[model samples]
Target: MSRWLPWAVGLVAAVLALGPALGPGYVLRYDMVFVPDLSLPTVLRGADGFPRAIPSDAVVAALSWVLPGDAVQSAALAAVFVVGAAGAARLMPSPAAAVVAGAAYVWNPFVAERLLLGQWAMLLGYAGLPWVVGAARGPLAGVVRSLIPAAVGGFSSVVLTALTAGPVALWGRGGLRRGGLLAGALVVVSLPWLVPALTAGAAGATTDPAGVEAFAPRADTPLGTAGSLFLLGGVWNAHAVPAGYGDPVAVALRLALCLAAVAGWAWWLYRDRPGFGPGLTAAAVLGFGVALLGATEPGRGVLAWLIGLWPGFGPLRDGQLYVAPLALVQALGLGAAALWLSRPAGGTADGPGDGGAGAAGRGAGEPGSSAEPGPAGPGGRRAHGVGRIAGVAAAAGLAVLPVVALPGLLWGAQGALAPAEYPRDWLAAQAAVAADDRPGAVLVLPWSAYRGIDWSGGPAVVLDPATRLFDRRTVWNDDLVVGTPDGGTVVVRGEDGLAREAAAVLGPDPRTGLPESLDAAGLAALGVRYVAVSAPVDNRFWSDVDGFSVVVEGPEMTLLEVLAGPINTEEADISGLEVTCGLVTVGAIIWSVARSGSSLGFQRTGVERRPGARKEIP
Candidate 1:
């Protein structure tokens, strides 16, 4: 209970501090466009409902049953920060060190940019890193423990965790066997998303190599990319940078802090301590290397080769995403730095209750009765001098904390800003969509999937709310859009033809009527029955639209009923595969739980004897 007190307090405090930004309204930024639609079966299935490969969608869908969809999304965001902090603490030597590292991890420029860009899906992977680290270090460590976060966060965390497990197994006794078990566990958990992702190409959801490189970290060379990796500043969207980010002073300050943090952590790593293991250092370097691969031509070639081998490997398109593991590394480094700053005049940080080697051993949960002994006394003057330099650098890092955290970062987490409230017109439009008794799809005009909805109070590109707003089946564009409202027409960055068709259907001349250019028969073939037009976009094309009548016209939306023909195409058949994967995951989980002396049906507990220990109740 005492072990949990710090975490509970920190989580509650974080929620209160962040509530204003994340409470009530729906954030309309980037992929947050889809969060509100978490309850929709079609969205959970993803992209024309052919692929149930989106693990985040599955989590949202499951939670939506118990909580409001928006609340679930909000809670999930808070959980990422909270869990990430907990994980940082779990991997650190003392509570204070953990708090510093947790703060660094959750409240950094990288986290801010991702949250602002609405990369909550990827953030889940980031949040799960600490858990992966913790599980790897525990006495009962196994493949299942190492890969459980993968079940929650998908392949991103799986790759990162696997990297961490590599050094863990390789650098320790029985390493190979343990590593193999971890790999097998990863495969089992991955079947949920991996099986569907492998088959997604057949469902027209393939990501071309060009698309894969679209969000590649932009750097002059692999070395430059590696440099940026440690700094935590390689977002694909330049606009995603924090306010005043490029200022010379800000850059220099951030760079200095980054170096200090890394140096401090490096110092701690060399110590024969029980803090974060060698695996984290190895994982950080590997993650940085992978992130750099996208920026260099040779690296891109390697990436191309990998993509060629695995079709489901498309999500790694955002090369910057690989920087996730590094963020944790930086946090750890900063935590180690903080410990150095708190050290007394002595070079050795073995003071009573100081959380140096002793705290490290306890935190690591190593099979030891007490902290390892330190040198009998302070060694020399040169040692103290070197310690002082490291302490000063750590202090500098502490200074830069606010600059990287605060609301100055691209308007401080766009998704966390006051939520966009559902307008009355949106409610009416949703009701209208719900009234359609026939099986049909609702298409929102100005057909691009990403739009700069003015209500969210920022220029961040967000997914069209219509996808979630309409309770009926939705026929919308499928592409990763990155742009601003003032930037004019939103650009379709992905190579999906359906997205291009959506742009073409909207036509070059938006002032002209939509039906004038659209073939009603063609649309009928796709099962589109109604079109909802939101404000600020030209709807003159609808004035001359034939065979359709305005069903509901509100301040925010104009719904038009399609009168032409019945849609002919068969609904996609994905239920069988979705069900199969769900059943397999559930079965595995149930079996694992049962083997652990637990039951989902009722409260049942059992304990067995361990070697050199007495038998427990069963």
Candidate 2:
């Protein structure tokens, strides 16, 4: 009945350690806020303001449904991970081994944030992993075998989670094979949500423009590469590695101790008969090294790298900075060492009397049984070594967890500093165009406001009662825009240095030696609507142009709707298809999942997904 003592102790310790995040710090320190933008009720988009991005929206939506309170839902996620880490910790042979691995895990910035924020699906994945590793150990008596699956099936996001537990279902042997098959069936059950994400161009297809561009890789490759591997953790957000982890002083010391611990344990394992599977040990070491180096890419990653070549390895782009294979390696290395140490030197049976996982206590079998322990000769040495590693890790954690995780508790995770606000006055000026125009009208706004365009929400924002314009795309001198007969819009950008270029745009084409200026008659000829000028450029733009009535002029921006009326005569020669380049990635994901990969398939996309538009109340 009590064969699972180590696991239970580990679980309790994990819980007690991390419970602090669920309180005041989580809200102030995370993106998960109680402020409701109400974007979850419908689809969310950027400029089109019509069809919504369902994948990211759906997860938030689900949370809205399950737990009515946002804070509760958020804390619940942290709790889930606490349980997951605990369960995984519990699976280790000794509480000390669990402590070392758990310390490495909790100290990781990404891991802590994921647990603290409502990364519900990821926490589930984390929960399932312990079971997967434990079940791989064959059989354990006293504990209910049925509990094995709870660990494996833990992290299935409706879309990507399938990839996580999918591999085992294919060709695994014994319990893992059976459970993998069962998990595969369960993933199949979730196909309704997963299949459409593949076809629709959301899941693997996404390549967020806003994320990766902020960190220019082409500009600095090596630092970027190392940083991508070190910090950021995922491909999309993979940028500069932080000063932690490999902290010149901290990591150097940690590595020295880890090396020393490994040396002691290796000697212990090689002493007597020289048993233990070489393949298992090799896999652990290799996995640990790669994981320690961390994930270089975010999403699915570059097509053919050695680690990525492995099936399911594609999605496992993040969290490798310090967790992933490191956990498994530590597990195997420590487990083997523990087992080896518990062996009595002279070969005398210690039975359940020795202070090891002693012969199946309680309902567990007696001396010669399957789950029983051997003699306790030098078992104390390995236990002591494992304990030393934990002490080192704990010491390192004490150093970092305070300096890093403490103040992070004060603010949300997005920008460490407050970003300058967008010029809402220009947006408000643009907003006025809707009031003057007819219902469901298309209003062409300046390209600058495109970032927050979709916040208008629902049926209203798509075709507002304003002139329809491609604010994010079409701009002054844009070929199709200037060539079109739609004039009920505005063009806003920095007019200071751009005057000459602006003059050239509204004037003629020097390249072809042709004149393209639309006169007052040309304004009607080119669907002249509005040209909202931001700030005071030169008076020349107003003087040169024939008819520009100032409908409303604010402190910083000016509204310039053309008096020439609507010119629907000609359509702009716009080219290119409206493709969500990020969504196009589904093809590659489909190909990879169907085909074979090189190593163990990667497991997670640790970066946060885009947030839904938060529409301001009228």
How many pairs of residues in model 2 come into backbone collision? 49
Best by lDDT: 1
Superposition error at 32 for model 2 (Å): 5.9
For residues 168-204, write the lDDT of model 2, one tens digit per residue. 2232235365444445444433333344444433333
Q: In candidate 1, where is summed lDDT lowest over 10 consecutive residues?
A: 601-610
> What TM value does model 2 have?
0.44
Q: What does the lDDT read for residue 448 in candidate 2?
A: 26
Quote the lDDT for 30 in model 1: 72
Cα shift from native, residue 335, model 2 (Å):
6.5
Angstrom error at residue 468, model 2 = 24
